[model samples]
Target: MTKFIVKDIVDKFGYDVLAGKDGINRAVKIYGINRPGLELAGFDFEKNNINRRVILLSNKEQLFVNTLSEKVKKERYEYILNENIPMIILTEKFTDKILLEIAEKHSCPVVRASNITTSRLYQLVLEFFDEHFAPATEEHASLINVFGKGILLRGKSGIGKSEMTLELIKKNHLFVGDDRIIIKQRNNRLYGQSHEMLKNLIEVRGLGILDLSKIYGLQVLLDETKIDLVIELIHLDDEQYKSIDRLGIEYKYIKILDTKVPIITVPVTYGRNVSELVETAVSKLKLDEAGISCLKILQERFEEYSK
Candidate 1:
């Protein structure tokens, strides 16, 4: 389970602290945001799951609270604050004295964002929560995005993974990460990124460490990408290579988190253009995805001829 603190939100979003400064250490468990508009309209607000969420009061909600009678306003505000929500956010400079007072009394953090509108604030907050709460793991591999398709290269150390990645970058493909790849799972899709310290950097045997962004320009570096294909490089003898499947009809998959990504095995041999071969493999994968599998088409024709 992932946990985000009120202070994390404040630091990330640059929200102003209006009240409950001491409660900034509170934990936010839910990834959803609540508007509290229905609650201010005399509706019986659901408090069961309110404590886990960040409640927001936009301009329209603040206006609705202002129009209510003093007794009703106090009652509603008291009911909401007593629920001990993780935090409350006010958008577009909205500030209500009573709401702030009640939040302070209950020790619930209240924050204000002056620049963004209500809808935009909601969108931003939800996006942040989605990323912060997603499941993540790390891998020892090189990740690159070729023609908008993410390709992961895995092999033993000193097996030319980084060298091949550099070649692909020279061919104008985007470099995601080298040596270490941080993968996060969201909505059953795995997204890969490099560690902050290693971003835009790759280590080659003779060249040592090279900053790709500086050498190949900014277009050569990619911040992150989905893991679409996993290619494992193997150093096999000529006979061993000949023994492997040649039809390319066998389906192989590698599981990352809960998603299964197609895997291709490439032999690393002397005089072999591994970089171009990997590029061709990616093209074939894309064509297969588009229902144009060459192997499948040939198999269909062979079956028809046999009949």
Candidate 2:
């Protein structure tokens, strides 16, 4: 989990370290005072420990710092922090004395931002938090970005997921995470990205780590994807008898962060165009999003004709 502290924002935003220089690099924890709406959405508002959740403050809004006494500060800090909130974001250009005192007493890092508006600062903070504390999910597959949606493909080690991705590259899909996909939960949405080390490298059965750019050229490799869809490939079973959705009746869910992503199961049978079927599924998903469904539409038309 990546925690955000005021110091982290200052360093990233090029603000001068005012008071809590020591705490500047400390872990970020969520605080109760972040947003009222966030609390309603199931986030603990009062917890004060360094975790993935980051508490952002804006100095421009004019908080009542003068009315806050040392005793009051300590009491309020303890009161809200008991709820398990993370770091505190100070938007106001605060004095070094106040920052130092907060750091020493509460062990919470305070950050200062100059020249940037509160809204812009909030966006930067959110982005930082999202990247820092991405959730942990098992990575048995590779994810790529086709058009704009994130596509996750899974198969056995030797089932040619990477090879299929190579073919999709010819169809103009962008590259994303390969081998391992890192998912992060932000405000409840799941975002996926590729690992830094294994990115753009695929392992074949006989060959070791092969650079995708060298083999398939620069166009074949991608940096990251969001994981909008999950595709699972399995060996064909006759007697085993698998039940697939002929009417798209079944839906599969893959939990990335706090959200569940749509999944499609594709059986890898001989003499079938697996890659093309996956592509068709992708297109079909898009159409489904637009309030269109071939099966449903056909059924409706038939009912109307019968009427």
lDDT per model vs. reference:
0.85, 0.64
The estimated TM-scores of all candidates read: 0.79, 0.73
lDDT of 2 at 23: 53
Q: Candidate 2 lDDT, tens digit per residue, 80-113?
A: 4322333555556544254346554665555566
Candidate 1, residues 1-307: lDDT per residue as tens digits?
A: 3467999999998989999887999988777887777677756446665455788887778778778887898888887775458899988656678888878888889999987877888888887887888888889999999888999999888789999998998899999999989998877898999987899999999989999888888978889999989998888853546656778876588888878888878899889999999889989988988889898788899999999
Predicted model with the maximum lDDT: 1
On a 0 to 1 TM-score scale, where does candidate 1 land against the true structure?
Answer: 0.79
Candidate 2, superposed: residue stretches over 4 Å from native: 1-8, 29-63, 66-110, 216-220, 238-241, 254-258, 300-307
Candidate 2 is scored at a TM of: 0.73
